[model samples]
Target: MKQKLWDHQLRARELKREALRKYGSTVCVSPCGSGKGTMIADDAIGAVSKGHTVQISVYRRILVEQIAERLQLNGIRYSVQMPDLPDKPWAIRDQHADVIVSSRDTMAAILRNGGEVRRSDLHIIDECHGFETLGYQTINKAVQPRWLLGYTATPVRPDGMGLSNRVFKSMVEAAKIEELIEKGMIVPVEVYVPVKTAKRRRSGLKISANGDPIQQWMSHAYGLRTVTFCSNIAESKMVRSEFVANGIAAEHVDANTPREEREAIFTRLLLRETLVVCNVGIADVGWDFPALECVQLLTKCGSPIAYWQKTGRVARNYLDEQKSRGVLLDHSAAMAEHGWPNLSPLWELSDREPIQKRQQERFGESAPSDAKPIICNKCGRGSIGLRNCPCGNPLFRDSQEKPETAGENLSLIGDAAEFAVGKKNYQKEWTNILYMAANHPTGSKSFAWAASIFKNKFHDWPEKFSVTPTVPFDERKRSIVEVYPQFMRRREAV
Candidate 1:
């Protein structure tokens, strides 16, 4: 069932030459349906041609079998660790196959219990993030492949580190979502942010299981072929039950879903046999179905990796011209948090957020990006260069200045003029803006202070205060104090 590889797939395979020539280890990152498994097979064939033996390690047995199938389809010689295969190597040295495909855990046991698979000339870690595991470390110590290859779409860790530091020496991006969309390789996405929370309450019409709101929205817009990420198994089952009861013919895929059942569900989805499927993070990574047109986010996740992986499910474009635009339904308001996936930046395995990466490029490694800068209120001198003031009088530490850092997306505010806070405390904010815009009586110091507060609220530049209203000062002060600190993290990207 092998087909000719596309240009990006060929280009990714070609780049592996550089991976081996320079870094010894490299991560080839591309979106799903971009032929990653094909690229891996081509890589295996290339290495085998050069008289190099290869061992491809996958995180799971399911993916290992899939990779094995690809290798076989490509006419590449391979072996595995199954009981049915009499050639399944019990000892690493006995593995003479051109390409050996096995789970990372199996390899770990082989390396630990005196087995010999690590002796290959090249090792391809399929889901290379598993490189962080002790098994990977143990195997690497045992075999130490001359050329190492890692593959991942989201190559990062939650602790603000990239995979480059551990598994791959450097990473090569095969393609971005934007690049693929432009080339018509993937579908473009439309992000929708519903204002009201999705829930089943007594605000009723005839709805199933109190889940009428989401179903109503789905019926209004979005294809029936959908995969939803829920908070937990309970939520997933509830959504599935509701959809099934409503004649959508849906099912739930959870941690407990058997491998056979999971395969059947995915096959049914591809064959257009089901309308909607709900899962508790099961489909978050590595479920590639191009027919999926809608991704319903029912659970709120803070991880950008989870957000990116979940988003990739819908944008897969197999039919090319026949594929309509992908739709994202942000029931959990995740759109407001993570932004559109295609528009999101590509992060290296060891890199932090874009702003921090820029900060490292500018401020040097000694300085941390998250560390807030100290600005002098009296002299208007900020932490960008110096700490002390030139005026001789020591500038008092003003916590009130620049309270909001940047990174919470400022683009969320659609209408800046429509924003209002009717209170005396915000009036200070308003007055400060009016003064700053005028370059006024208190000098630029007040201007800077006001702009920070303004950016925190509007998430953008302020033009004019056409109306002045009156209200309680405490609430105004409280709201400003509350909003900026939380949103400031998103401003770092700017």
Candidate 2:
């Protein structure tokens, strides 16, 4: 059966058309499982039928294979560029495939080898947010596809360096998780964390350092296939052990796990032999399984990309038909700092202006202190761990006492404190966006749920419910403060 995208995706299609009219190059920010491949395939098939060729550049070989399958399923003739695979013939030649799907390395080699991109051919850059690398630079200068379209869910880098206008000129297509949930396309997420614990318990599992949180939510995966991410290799092993001890058919795999062994585990997962599989960085990106219903986040993730990607594992509809909304078993405070997946933040990554600068210019206000997340002192990525940051660097001095436990919640410590404020202010910062969501003609119960999350964590309803009134942005901010206190004062009153 040919799949029809949800209503929002249809709107996204129109947005893509509008953006292309405005700019030659545009970033299409479609959420996961919104039929990005379907959209791409539709264009490829139309262009191919018209006798114009197209080339799709991707980061991983797996993506190339996936795109080819989508094209084939649509009955579109296409060729892949993975010569190293024994069964498939080499595809390094020029202008041969009706629709070309290849990796950056493969595409760069083709261009370096003097392969030409015909003027009518469309070049689709998959995972287009990752355009900051040298490999992408090489491909850009060498090949010129007449029509350029880049697609990604999370387009903004955590380090704050965005794709420039020279690369992705404007946002062509966009949709939010809330919109998808309202349309029953993707599963909506319910984040579970005890917001009001009695002060701080000095012992047991230290809740703040992103401690072993899987045990808290592992039960949620009962009789369901799950993918869990841990903070480190040892933690991954421990989580796998916990699940195994419970007789849940669990296993752990890491970067060192042999290819054959890893493939075997995935095969088990496919056959319903393994209930849960745990890993660190490997499971964070491009690991697609439509049956994934729950994700247990155990990492102290500082990047929005990590949070969005991890939660997105379960954002797609479950194939088993036993589940409706996706359940997020978050113990690492990942959602607290970043807010919910499929919300406005992910959609805002394409802003030509930097968020920080835009806020300063529009409102003359600096972002909340929490907006400045702790970055890895070494790699300059976001950091939340006290000792060995996720990047494996020492974030604190030896002289400084590591909290008696490895994990510390949002307090005292440097980076922890920085992120703590962000977590505390998630609702305050996103008020205007949530207000528009709650009151718009297309508004949903999601706004009420988001408000409840804010009230639970911070003990107050978000105040910006009226911010998007019939007024300009500047007056909106001023009137927002005047009307915010008028909302229900506390969760208790409700």
Provide the RMSD of all predictions against the true structure, rounded to 1 decimal. 17.2, 15.9
Which portions of model 1 miss their true places by more than 4 Å? 1-3, 60-62, 83-94, 105-116, 133-135, 195-213, 220-223, 352-494
Worst 10 residues of 1 by lDDT: 408-417
Candidate 1, residue 4: the lDDT equals 79
lDDT of 1 by residue, 1-494 (tens): 55478787777777878867998888777665566777777788889988999888776666666777777666677777643343432322235578888777787777667867547898887666556643576676676788888877766664435765555788887877777877877766654433222111111112111124344433322223688788889988887887766546688898788988998998897755776788888876766677787787766655556777798888888573266456666555443344445543536556545322432333232335322223344432223223343323353434425322121111111111112222113444454343322332222223344444454343333344432322243334332223333222212111
Query: In model 2, what are the clashing residue pairs, if there are any?
Result: 208-408, 208-409, 209-407, 209-408
User: What is the per-residue lDDT of model 2 for residues 123-230, given as tens digits with 9 covering 90 to 100?
Assistant: 777777777653665665555666677887767666434566767777754567677666666766555433211011111123553334444443233334677888
Q: Could you tell me how far off, in angstroms, the CA of residue 293 lies in candidate 1 after the best superposition?
A: 1.8
Candidate 2 regions off by >4 Å?
1-6, 49-51, 73-77, 85-95, 108-120, 160-164, 194-207, 210-214, 349-494
Task: Give the best candidate by TM-score.
Answer: 2
